[model samples]
Target: MTTPTAKRWEIVDLIANRTVTAGEYKPSIKDYLSELTVKPLTGIPVALAVLYAFWSIFSSFAGALVTDGFMVKLFDNYWLPWIQNVWPNPDSVLYFLFVGDPLADNCFEAFGMLTSGLFVSIGVVLPAIFIFYLMMTILEDSGYLPRLAVLMDGLFHKIGLHGYAIVPAILGLGCNVPAVTATRNLETKKQRFIMMVLLAVFIPCGAQLGIMLDVIPETVGWVMLYLIIGFCLFGFILGKLIPGGNPEILIDIPPYRRPALQNICKKLWVKTKGFFINAIPFVLLGILFVNVLYLLGVIQALADLFAPLFVTWFGVPKETVGPLIAAFLRKDLAVAQLSTIAMTPYQMITAVVLISIYFPCVATFVVMLKEGVKELAAAVGVLAVIVFLYGGLIHLIGILLGVA
Candidate 1:
């Protein structure tokens, strides 16, 4: 009969079967995995709840700072001077009205969205996302994210999706491009498609939502709430419609701990850098594109091309054409430009919602191409068309219901 010590040695030897480690420090896979379980899970949803509250408060303060202070000055002092340097007629109403239009100003300062709206829009939005990501990363590293997946599984399963889709939902709050790109983590094609299209359609990014609240007032809050409800309902319906295999989840959950400061900064740098590098150029280029389009009268061409739909079908002003085109580049910027226009609360609500899911930003677009599902590209086009159509529909429906 083997002694107790011999039994321990045998277990060690069995664990070390794959290695040649003198059979001393080896252990079974069960033992190794058990080491991970020793740390108690204070749970995931609680951490997420904490994080949501943090972002909401901080983001509003940042948006207010930029809108009232930095934004006001950048336009008044710097942008005005730069425009004057080019047009020599900086004080003109047209110059003030369409701050980025190149007519009475050099194209440099005429980029209204990048200059005027950037601070309040991006400065506020990015920080909020950063705080959110920071909390998410801590939760993730601490093993809360996996447990979160488990906790959410029952509800998510009813929607025909695995709970892992929560990762993209978090990302979608930051931006859809990264969220779509993240679908790579999902095992099946169907999970990826449902997550991608649903995320693209329903989720409003941190920046757009922040600015919408800042610019539109209390009623926009109602629109925002309605849109969120719309997202959940549609997301559930799409998940049911999409067919997919659910892979069994097996994740290593680490004990919760302080995320290293270096890691948070690195994450912040990578994400924010990626965001701006994609954003700034597109914003400038969109303004440039508009400048050229206006120069060549292509905008007029498109407006004339679709005049009936612009005036009759959508119930928005014809001038909204420029902002709509600009949205393909950056939705927040396009929405900012829309603030300069005179429209009713209903029109504003409809326009904002339309642009909310209008399309992924340029950075996100590249991610879509890279993720490379044949259906997703088509989904992008479909979502864009739906954004406008749905926006109009929502407005019409709300009016009929007396909510509008």
Candidate 2:
């Protein structure tokens, strides 16, 4: 060890096994890029640009080419027709389940496991899932996400959440189930509850985003913008409303490095495979549940039951009641159901918005309950109020913007 009185410039160079005085090298591209991401003045813009690029690639390009161009044609032109041709009887449960009422002129109207199920699951959602995960994995592997968390630390601090809360928020974009579990990373019960509530209410998972992009391509950005704004605003509101002391962020930021292709592919495959494995069954089950409800005339009963709430208050059709119920099982499927309904853009926007905020899926609900029963109950109550309030108010916003 060096003496306490040693001069600062006389430090030892034992690691290199030499008495080297100093070393110097020019800053590399990675260092320059790091500077751009860490500085407050430039970091936010860079983050926005990066997000915009990912959105364009996921929503516009993959959505248009893979989901719309390929999946839509495959589903509508081939899959639905083939299934319908084989099961043509209007009165049969099989026919109705696979080919819905033939009156509505859209694939979503069919609501079959092979028709809308295949269409929404394969056509619209698959591309979005793949692209969003691909970009997300890239970001994760590159060490940029931590830098982003650092950059947003100030804003998150004001919300009574630390920058690390961004982890669950980012995870939520992939799937809310895991995201809810991720809230355990927070130090306090109140923080976990707040994070869970905000995520469940505002953050649209990748699968939901995928279908939304496919159906309402032009308005997805605006819809996403609304949700993102709600995320921060509600986080701050919850910070104040809930009794808790805001904690300072403690995180480690790693140097930027090129992501390995093999690791990226492995992670991408694992996440996407998990989503498909978990979500597809729920999608199919939702279709079957909808069919059973329809056959029993329960759908009409539900439609009537929620008509005043969904139709009068939210400005969406009463048929949305089925999708709203489906949301309890799977939100992406609920969003998929919107494609079949006849509605103005305003109605569709409100429907998607409500679907996102109405409630967490069964998986997330269980996780939240496991985290804290009382808190989960409070969260459920809050969800009810928000779903109705935001769902109704968005229509007015859409009308004022003249998009309705």
Candidate closest to the true structure, highest lDDT: 2
197-304 per-residue lDDT for model 2 (tens digits): 999999888879887777677667677777877777777877888897767777778889889999989998997888788877777778888788878989899899
lDDT of each: 0.65, 0.80
Candidate 1 segments exceeding 4 Å error: 1-9, 13-48, 66-71, 74-114, 117-143, 217-220, 247-249, 310-314
Candidate 1 global CA lDDT score: 0.65
| Root mean square deviation (Cα) for candidate 2 | 3.6
What is the per-residue lDDT of model 1 for residues 106-201, given as tens digits with 9 covering 90 to 100? Answer: 222345544454554354455555555666666666555665665566656665667677778777777777788777787788777777777777
| TM-score against truth, every candidate | 0.76, 0.89
- TM-score of model 2 vs. true structure: 0.89
RMSD of each: 6.7, 3.6
